[model samples]
Target: MPYPIVAAVVATMVLLGIYLSTAAPDLTFWDATELMAAAHTMGIPHPPGTPLWVLVGKLASMLFSSAAPPRAITLLSVWSAALTGGAAAYMAARWLGARGAVVAAVSAGTMLTVWNNATETEVYALSLLVSVLLLVTGEFAGRPDTDDHERRRARALMAFVCGLAVPLHLTVLVALPAAVAFAWRGPRPVWREVVAWVALAALGLSAIAVLPLFSAQNPTLDSGNPESWRALVSVLRREQYAVAGLWPRQAPLWLQLGNVFQWSDWQVAYGLHPFPTAHPVRTALTVLWAWLAVLGLRRLWRHDPRVGRAMLLLVLSASLGVALWLNMRAGPTFGVGLLPKGTPHEARERDYFFVLAFWGWGLLAGAGLSAIASALGRRLPAPVAMLPLALVVVPLLANRAVADRSREPVASLPRTYARLLLDAVPRRGVLFAGGDNDSFPLWYLQQVEDYRPDVTVITVPLLGAQWYRERLAAQQLLEVAAVARWPGQGAVLRSLVIHAEGARRAVRVSTLLERSDRLQLDPGGGWALQGLVYAPDRQLGAGQTGLDLPALRRQRSMVPMGALAPLPPGADPAAQTAQELLQCTQVLGPADSLLVSGCGGV
Candidate 1:
């Protein structure tokens, strides 16, 4: 077999082994659950609708149907990551040779951000794959010795792939100009062929049409419901998330820029993080890694300047350009803007956005290490001289403690919460969920696993939308005007609970709303304890004040909660349950202690 093909296959197998060994056994929090459920049902996800991933994930889900629904869907990310490692290895091998391939593989494969993306159903893993492939393809297409016809074919292929990224995620736009320029090579542009390639690229972008196509069928979790031309345009343009043209800045520009380095410093020595625990060691390793990357990039410029220059542009576009574009709010600051008292923030860290940038830097570091090996050739044997490249594997080892999800307790929390809550809600009830974690898992369990299909889950955040309101009004048999009349989200929710009561159905709310000041759940005001969730019907209490230990135990037995048992007091909100339960809500037993600690805020 050809060397590049062999290199890709060998690297893919090795990395896939590591990735699968640590892959989440079930669906996870954030977008992973929603995307998995959407793929399984051929439904739509949030804005711009990620149709390409939906189609691809659908196939993976079917092929791996024997696994749990979330785990099956998560395989897509695992494969994308493995393929990414393969591409990185091949790219490094092109200039750094076999030893360079090892350095690049170790650096890219186990970088904390990249590994995190690999374990779940998320877009960035696949986005990183395509971006790396573009670098490889553009490098080949940029070769001066390549035949004209072949080069044009390669460039045309590059254009179509680039177009596919439109639906994948617009983040790829930063990598575009560099990739296109490199593919142009020495040939003077052929206008007619260029136009034809552009047309073909548009055709690839049309993959997004799956949003309207599948949406018209009205799947269970149609996020935007972009079935009509107008709605489709709105979804495609991302008007729902459009924040007045990416400015009026979400965070101070300096803090946002500072996050670029903040994210970078964590890549190689991520295990020593929550930093300051081993600050000196972390800083030294990070500096050494950066120094090697700069050296490698410099050597590449002196040797293969054409490709080297394009790569620097690609890395900058992927990292710094992305940081500016994202303009995210304060996310896990390392003393920079530590007190940005009143700024919007991301729900979670956004380091995954820079996977392409970090992965590219790893390849450069591999080349730089090879350059060092050459410099010491006279002093050391050829095989022995290259031993220093093995040191690059330090990142893979350092990050493993944090990045490995195989036995991580929090990784399985989403699945556990979804299953427990779904099983606990009374049949044909209305479950009002508070946030992404509180709501998405229910949707996945209902639509994909066919669990508690009769229950109506109303996500609180989406209630403000007219379409969402109308859908709820229709499903629950409420008057449209009455549904719209609610003065605020709190009012809208109270109405839903009352409506469920009138219709002889049970009412429940995720812990967020229950703990919130939004509703009147003061004992006499129609609310009862329902294990992990809260039932809003005073009737079920039967004079009870604490949890139903038996019910909680049954729910616990049904799902695998991983290693952690009974979250301790004052745990993070994502891991907490029943805020009011914290008022000395005494523990029942180890088995039912998910939130039984009765003194925390999840």
Candidate 2:
């Protein structure tokens, strides 16, 4: 079979698998829903904002008329990314040919960041697609044989696409250096052609201004308010740390440099610092693939300085952009708090320009592999020369094929939880859920039922105590006990509490069983109750579990029990909840052996 055909097949299968696995009723765990919600509403005022990409999602949702708007947007993104991958492969093949292109395409498809973003409603895929187009067109325009008309056309196209790209992601700025290099390389161009190219480039670059025009929900100057501006400035000032360290205070220059060289290695082998357990297998493969790509670029540099220079510029620009974006958005702080505390910020931050790094590196790797095989091609029989190449190709393709199948079920967890909560709680009742990785449950329920106006979904501090308190007062119920509440009318005293200190708090689960008699034991020996909590906890079962049903019913009809289970020592039952509430006169104090009334009614 032709190498192009094989590359197409591999790319298609990989994309299809990702789309199928991820397309569902809810959002991916990584706050994709928050972005989708903003996208659906065409609001750009939020952080990590992507005005152009959100518009694309909104348009697709309207066009398809699908009930699952986010899924539709995600599917569209996947398709676009797949096409981008194909275009990239074609370009690589055109530049390096056959074997090199196949390696590039396969490497891209297997890339953890690329595959992950393809299934999300983020701008990463769109940015990647536009970047690939820009690179390819720039390459074509720089060709020595290209005519004035063709070069002008390519320049205009590049400008228009770049213009469209800027609002989607600010990182598109990285392409400018590459563009300048390409424009300067070709034969002495006609002055008229140069003027046209410059004019088009300016026009394309202007599209970034439109970002502020999109609804106030976008991350532009209009929506962020004075504080947002302050945050942006704060982030900008820390640009050095953003690219180098976990935080400004603790960052060391040497360490940051080490991180850059060994980032792929560290991310894959040890994983990222906060989410150390994140996609280990993918991380490892990415590191290996990236290293190989660097090798390829080194070999190509000796022969094609232009290609080498272009690759180097693109990689450095994109890497710096991504690192800075991640730093600003994820935070100079280490661990999970690296990202902003809100869903909106998380959604936006997740679209860092790292995929560009992956692409540049992948191309370099393909070039490297091709150069190696070509060297052997001169001395050995054709089949013998191909043997080493085959070994590398088969494993990579297989890895991509396998990795494509490993996507997390974005829709399943939130949808299932929503169903369970909807069925478990009264139509008008408020549910207090502990920790949610993605904001999917809230968004999915809002889409299916108009209950968002009535239903309150809170995620501890990320949801903010003030907001949670306000919602609790309005709803007249506290669904989750993990949240801390100030003294208030609508607030009920919790009997049992669970809190996880540090980053684990994000994953901690808190449940409030309205009635103790309703509790049942599951086959796995985990307690089954009216409400289930999912929070981050160092010691799994150490938090306050058993609630006094009889006392709870007698004293407070709507009893709210919370557990603050920190890392090692755990929460002292007498100090955290029981005594704390007693001081507020909300608890039935000095009561021993409270009698159990029948589990009468919910």
Candidate 3:
């Protein structure tokens, strides 16, 4: 086998082994559930729908049999990550020989961000794989070893791949300037070459059509519903989530630096348990790694200035560029922002966005270590000199235990929540679920596992949008106009109440709105809740109050009062059940105590 092919196979085996040993057995929180569900049902996911991923996931699903849909989707991540590790190893081997390959393998394989994504059903693994491919293809295309014909073909191929990668995950745009800069250094393409590249790129970008194609079938969780050209353009452009108002206000320069500092720490030590606890030791290691990265860049520049400059650009663009963009707050939208008071929020962790930076640093570190080994080889016996390379085991050992999720039952909580919500609502009921955690799993359970086909779940945040309203209208027997009038939670809640009362159907709100103050929940008013609201005619007693646990206890499908916890602090409003549960003095057992203690800001 060829050197690059061998290196790729070795890296793939190593990464796949680790990932399989640690893969999430079932659904994960937030995007994992949604992505898996979307893939299983051939539905479009959140803004800028990943049609390429959906197609790949569907293919993976058919080839791999699993207990559930998420398992199959997670396998896709494993394969992508393994391929990424393989590509990273191949790049190092191609650039710096056998020793460099070893160093790079350790650097990329042990990265926390890569390992984290490898365990779930997210798109980052594929993003990482494509990134490595883009860098490798671009690097190899301009190399002296390649003939003119091959170089031209490689550049065009890189262009096409770049185009495909961008629409798949917009973050892949970080590679654009670097790819272009490297391309300029090579032979200028003639008109035909340019057109060929452009045409191929156009072909690659046509993957967006997958959304409209699948959407026409109306799958269970058709996010964005890109059935028409206008809707297709809107989703592909990410217009819904692209609002400037959704971004948080920019932070002070120092805080932004701190943000970078924290992100740097996470690159290697995120999954390790005791690694973070030993702050002084951990900080020293991180600083040392940064220093090594700098040294490696310097060494690379001395060896090959073009490659060194390319590596530098990759690091800067991926880290600093991404930091500047992410840190800029877009104010507020609907009085809620992604991360209200800046990053480090539990809901949205931004560290994953810089996987490219982590990859760059890993490559640099490998080069630096390889340089050191070369120096040692000149002074000492080869065997004696190779001993220092054993240090690569440090990160591997430290991150292994925490990253190993083979036994972890991550799906339990979401699965339980989905079952509880489904059971709480009556047959063919309309369930007004609160947020991502509250709603996405329901989609997964319903669409993938075939948990409950009758219950209709309307996500609260989507209620404010016309697309979502239209989607709900098409799926359910509800009037979009009346629902759209109230906007926010009020609109959805009122419609559910009216539907329950008039249509003789069941309608249950996951929890009452936090701005319960603005919208009246009185019996005669637009809103009302009694106990769990299991039935249409189950009117609340005078002053019975919102989300009564005692009443919920008596329901046919009982609320697990002992398992409830207070909603964590977020920019979004708190649900009534979660809000009231925080103040509940009743402790059924140790479970409730543990659950209560888990709630922050209680």
Best candidate (score: TM-score): 1
Worst 10 residues of 1 by lDDT: 578-587
Per-candidate clashes, comma-separated: 4, 42, 5
Q: Is candidate 2 or candidate 3 better by TM-score?
A: 3
Write candidate 2's Cα lDDT for 1-602 as tens digits.
76655665565565566555643444554446556665565544234345567677778778766556656767766777787767766666655666667666655554545655676666777777787778878877776777877877877787677666555665565776776566545456678766876777677656444444553333311222213444344322433123434555233334333334433432222222223233556465556666677777787577566767887888887776545434432322223433335522222223234667766766676666677777788999877876655534433343333223223221243444344444433343334443433234464456434434343344433233333343443433344442344533222323112111121221212242223211211111222122232222223243323333343333343322321112111111212222222212122322322211211111
Q: Candidate 2: global Cα-lDDT?
A: 0.49
Clashing pairs for model 1 are 296-368, 573-602, 576-602, 582-598
lDDT agreement with native, every candidate: 0.72, 0.49, 0.66
Which residue window of length 10 is worst by lDDT in model 3?
567-576
The C-alpha local distance difference test score for the whole of candidate 1 amounts to: 0.72
lDDT digits (tens) for residues 1-602 of candidate 3:
77877777777787788888878787666688889887788888888889998888888888786555678889999988888878877866766676567677667667777777888889998888887788878777767677888889889888788779745887777876666544545567899988898889988888887888898887777777888898888887778765433245454445554556566775655444333233666667777778778877888788767778888999899888876766643222211242455433333445678888887887787677777877899999999887767666666666666565544223244565567667667788877665776678788888888888788876766666568877666655457675446554554556655654566666566542233421322244332333323232235443233334444444423444433443222211223233343223232332454223422111
- TM-score on alpha carbons, each prediction: 0.88, 0.62, 0.85
| Clash-forming residue pairs, model 3 | 247-329, 247-330, 248-329, 248-330, 249-329
Quote the lDDT for 504 in model 3. 66
